[model samples]
Target: MAKSDSVTRSAVLHRDTRFVPKKAVGGKGSYIFLEDGTKFLDSTGGAAVSCLGHGHEEVSQAVINQINQISYCHTAFFGTEASEELARLLTESTGGKLSKLFVVSSGSEAVEAALKLARQYFLELPTPQPQRTRFIARKPSYHGVTLGALSVGGHMIRRQPFEPLLSSNTSHVSPCYPYRGKKAGESDADYVNRLAEELDGEFQRVGPDNVCAFIAEPVVGAALGAVAAVPGYFPAMKAICEKYGALFILDEVMSGMGRCGTLHVWEQEGIVPDLQTIGKGLGGGYAPVSGLLIGEKVVEVMDRGTGVFRHGQTYQGHPVACAAALAVQKIIQRDNLLENVRKMGAYLEERLRGCLGDHPNVGDIRGRGLFWGIEFVKDRESKEPFSPETGVAFQVQETGLDPSHGISLYASNGTVDCTKGDHVLLAPPYNVTKEEIDIIVDTAGRVIEAVFAKVNAA
Candidate 1:
């Protein structure tokens, strides 16, 4: 209908080869419109990037205003007011523990910067703690595709192809996935202790003295279907990191900036990460932007020693990006959108539970705030997952976006591990209304039922 068939026939190597996306011509509120005037609710915010939703005039105007004054300036020669203000807002939001901001153009860049900063922190120590060389992260995790971030990731499927090129200094422990990893009768406290112990063991195996930092997602986004760490998990993990003299780095690229009902997911866990990566929602998809907030301890080490961080990007603090992100952050706070995130998030969870909680194929409904995931299973009693060969998650994603359904939901495979289970994620915008939540759940439910019905028939 949009006449993209000709473009599809061209040489563009898209992310997927099977289908070409309908051209998005415009958007309003929560829905995107195509050239043919077809409207589809953007439930997942384009992989959780559009936090302010689409067509935010204020964000656009802010970007324009900054560009009019100073479109771009090299970080080496000059600093922009927009960049300075953005840093101030982030520092204020985090209560001043985060004193430094290293801006980049994408989530992967932010992750890469965080990792480099973590390792560099040790290298620049007064005593030059050379033994602090190892990095520890959790399994079933995703940081990014760049070499450094990829080296630290635990998604086997994504890592397998590049295993030879990955760093040997990185090690992984189990994720805090209660549905798959928790024992049948185990208490939450016990489960958390078990995970902490596992993390400690990995540190010991790698020689605790050699560990530089421990990285994890406060609420895992793409890699684990929005799985959250259990209560007290971060506190325990933070304690272990302290024991080993290791810094705590949390990757909140897809879960930060009020998406998880808080400014930072670690706040809910009752612990703060020493270095945190934030993206996606920061610029609200207006411009590509991501940044790392360095904690006071790390700042103190740098301040006492080298007094200058070693890593930076050409676009480390782009004025336009900073301006757009500043506007998005201000608008969110000004409107008290986080409160709506909490209220609407509760409604979303309830709606998801009421709609799909009892389905035999629906294995789990879990997450916090607006970030929710619905895992699928082949056998509910045994908690057995469908074979990856079936591609159940992909089927659900495809059918859910059919023109007849006119809805979109995020789908993911390998929810159990890096290659085993399947689930679909729903991360609607923080400002989503109750009616919007209902529509998303209802439309997604129909798609799930249709897919499983065919699976059962076969």
Candidate 2:
């Protein structure tokens, strides 16, 4: 709360209007300094956005350079080298598996644009698929908050308010959440087969060719709290999309850009999506940047037909944003941060398991690379999540915000279905040191223990 809780009548409406949050004056490396002179170690990097950490001189220089050269150029008029080079960097990173890039200012815009692009793609085909109007996504997933993205997103709490307004054409299936979704006797292979069959059934229910695309996150982010796909699950889903002639879309808005050890989470999953959305880490919080990576199939359609994508945004391909993202990507490559993510990700798992894995309330600890989550439960043996009224996850998160605990934790509720579960995410910067990992884990363990101690007493 710091000194902010005492204030009222803030002109700017915040996410939580009940209380004003502490004002963050500055940050560096893995820590943020508040106006109250408290220095909190940044563990989640503000929903896994600051992969390069806060206040990097190089990214600053890149943005400054681009501003000096030329800041904004509408894509409708002219193209800037900043956007062109950024696109080249993104596409080439895919090894030409994806051939085209469309940039935007945020993840929501990228997803909204991707949906429209998918629609346009079907329209421009050698044989147009005017009937391909629907989308299929997994439950407890989040793409973004924009109307179209909201329509595809399965986050119940987020979508509930706008349900009547959201597009009715989209539907949802079960995500590959092994901790809760798996049956008592189910093997990993059996669980995957079950999910695959479910997806295939949904495609059949909707009429195969009527679906424009099936979108999912490579690693489920805020909505499910860093839930990665089970082995063989993605390839199986892609096969269904292929059979239906529907595009496969991976929304890596929170998992890609080297957050999950590899440059792309699909690199580990062994299947390429027809469309991919990446952000959060793209500009490392230096500037607003998100993008759509288009596969060869759709690009071919656009190239042969209209030679244009039907979607456009005022801030698409923003020069300053592209420049910041370019520097962030280049720094990642030059510094060999992906290797650090792999090495540290393993150690992070080890540390978390050692410190908190056996906690009575800690039901599951899961994730890959630098992204991880800890799910809380009342009965560990039964995997029974605490009632949402308890606010177990956010209580632990709020405890950490105190200057005494001095660590940041990203909280998620409704993990079990949008109303019944709780978990917290820990996504540090790629270049985080082993020492920093020790501090983060140690502090987080203490914080979690402290909060749950109070819950038990109450």
RMSD of each: 1.7, 1.1
Q: Which sections of candidate 2 miss by over 4 Å? A: 1-3
Alpha-carbon TM-score of each model against the true structure: 0.97, 0.98
Give a tens-digit lDDT track for model 1, residues 392-436: 988898887777776667888877868889988888877899999
lDDT of each: 0.88, 0.92
* Model 2: per-residue Cα lDDT over 67-98, one tens digit each: 99998878899999988898898899998989
State the TM-score for model 1.
Answer: 0.97
* Residue 232 in candidate 2, Cα distance off native in Å: 0.6
The alpha-carbon root-mean-square deviation between model 2 and the true structure, to one decimal in Å, is 1.1
Mark the regions of model 1 whose C-alpha exceeds 4 Å error after superposition: 1-8
Pairs of colliding residues, candidate 1: none
